[model samples]
Target: MVMQERAVRTRAALIRAAAEEMDRWGYEGATLTRICATASVSMGALTFHFSTKDELAQAVQESGGAYMTDLVDGVAARGRPALRSVVDLTVGLARLLQDEVVVRSAARLTRERPDGHSWTLFWLPAVRDLLQKAADQGQLRRPGEPRAVAALAVYLMAGAEARCRAMIGAGGGGDRDVAEEMDLIWELTLEGVAAGSG
Candidate 1:
């Protein structure tokens, strides 16, 4: 039992180290040696857990996806208006990307991977579905254009993600800055989608 616990701890440490390294250097520049050094583990230990850097990257991506899924699920359960939920989810995700190195690195790795799927693939459908729901509930100003609104929401969230990633890479900014940006985004989005905003 002790051995298994230690192995799990060591693996988690390595994943975090790899994420930090990847966040700093991206996929091509992150090295196993640096990851091991950062994790304070030996190469043997790292190899035991992850046979290749690609595998490590995959792990990071999965971890990030899990985090995002949890956030999305939580928002979905809130029973809020679908438009509000979409805004909240996007801002929540941006905050996650801003604060979590693992998530940020996973996003970067996904971008760098040749076979990696787009992050939008994971979130866009949810956004579109929620937009459709909003329209069904008579929540949207343009009830006939849920697709257009979904596209706009996706573009805004994608932009926020990119901006947050860049800010994080450049050593981060105040949480207030992130909040303000999200507030502005929500304001604009609500103006476009609110029931009486026509």
Candidate 2:
């Protein structure tokens, strides 16, 4: 058990260090040597844990996806009210871009194409199901294509995060601004894209 615990600690330390370094220097600049040094682990240990830098990159991507999934699951269980939970889950990520860890990691992933969400097709259906249920329950308006709507929601969520990060260190965007953009999108969605609601 002690050995297992130590191994787990070492892996986590490596991920944490890699996340920090990736944020600081970006993917092209992120070096395995720096990660090993930051984690206080040897190259042999890193190699033992991960066969290659590619493997480490995959681990980080999976770790990030798992983190997002777990967060959605956790908030759903808390009974925080459904709509609030949706907003929080969607836009709350925008709020996370301010964090050194999340923002930098995202920057790194974008810099490295393999580390990005190029395979989100697997998760899109599940998201479609949830939104379809929401529309059925009257919490949201649904068009004939729930999958398209789900895709739009997901795109907007990620876009909001990127836009937020782009605006960071500028101190210009507030939650109110985000809320306003969301409100406009929702209005357009719920009321139809017809100009002036004509």
lDDT of 2 by residue, 70-119 (tens): 65676567656444455555554444444436433754575475536543
Give the best candidate by lDDT: 1
Note each model's CA RMSD in angstroms: 2.5, 4.5
Clash statistics: count for each candidate: 0, 0
Top TM-score prediction, candidate number: 1
Global local distance difference test of model 1: 0.84
Would you list the clashing residue pairs of candidate 1?
Answer: none
lDDT of 2 at 52: 77
By summed lDDT, which 10 consecutive residues of candidate 1 come out lowest? 171-180
TM for every model, in the order presented, reads 0.91, 0.67
Candidate 2 segments exceeding 4 Å error: 1-3, 24-26, 78-85, 96-126, 142-148, 167-198
